[model samples]
Target: MKKGVFLLCLALYAFSVTLTIFVQAAGIADEKLRLLSSFGSLISFFAVLAMLFLIFRLKDNKESKVKSCGQKQRKNPDEKNPSKEKYLEFAARNGLSRRESEIGYLVLGGLSNIQLAETLFISLATVKKHLTHIYEKTETSGRKEFAEKVKAF
Candidate 1:
């Protein structure tokens, strides 16, 4: 009976040790998985950065090649619009919003307030409001003076 009891105790101890070893191994594997996941994220971040760098480098290279080949860079339409610079200057001096500046430029084109409202998809009252502001800023009495000033600019 003593021998049987001793053997049973030994079997229980061995089973407990085996379980502890497996638990420790699982913990090590978990740590390794976390490390691998962090590395993957870091690699992907650098890959994206590298791709952006390459894209910008290629764009600059193309621009330089164009310059070397004597191809004139296309001018923006805004640059060609003679009144655009004057409107920009007016906006800067008057602290006008972009929409107001656009409306002012259109007013200089001989369009009435009602026509402006219809063309810009706004109500007549809104157009009149913008015009009032524009007139005050430019110190103009009416459309004739505004057009004359813009043309002089």
Candidate 2:
């Protein structure tokens, strides 16, 4: 994360420097207006690049998390939860308690165990226990893959 921010800052700095150089070189008759345009363009370019980078990073994280959860689930098949047609069905099939089911849902939604616990008003230890049960039932080894399976259900 720090690296990403650093890179973005570096990119912005380089862009600004380049824009200054270009404006100086163009030496248009309207020096003030040309400098302004160059500055504006640089700002716009950097903004677009930053937005794109953020979106890409978010998407990549989500996909990777999903993959990790799925791989975990595949590693253990003995803990097959019940097969409900709906998302609720997943909870029922898995024999997860009401709270466990809720936690599981959150986990499936890409929340970390700590995040889920906080959201659900539970202790981290309790959250881990619930996750253990969830993993056992869902046969997921990681949060990402578990989330994928839950989403599919």
Best by TM-score: 1
Q: Among these predicted structures, which one has the highest lDDT?
A: 2
Q: What TM-score, computed on C-alpha atoms, does each candidate reach?
A: 0.43, 0.41
Q: Which 10-residue window in model 1 sums to the lowest lDDT?
A: 71-80
Q: lDDT of each prediction vs. the true structure?
A: 0.64, 0.68
- Model 1 per-residue lDDT at 85: 77
What lDDT does model 1 reach? 0.64
Q: How many residue pairs clash in each candidate?
A: 0, 16
Tens-digit per-residue lDDT, 57-106, candidate 1: 66676566434433222233232334577678867787777888888776
Q: With candidate 1 superimposed using the best TM-score fit, by how many Å does residue 110's alpha carbon deviate from the native?
A: 1.7
Residue-wise lDDT of candidate 2 within 1-153, one digit each (tens)?
A: 845775676677667767766777777668686867678577757766776777788778667655554433333455444333466787788787888777775554556665555455578899888788888888988776776677667
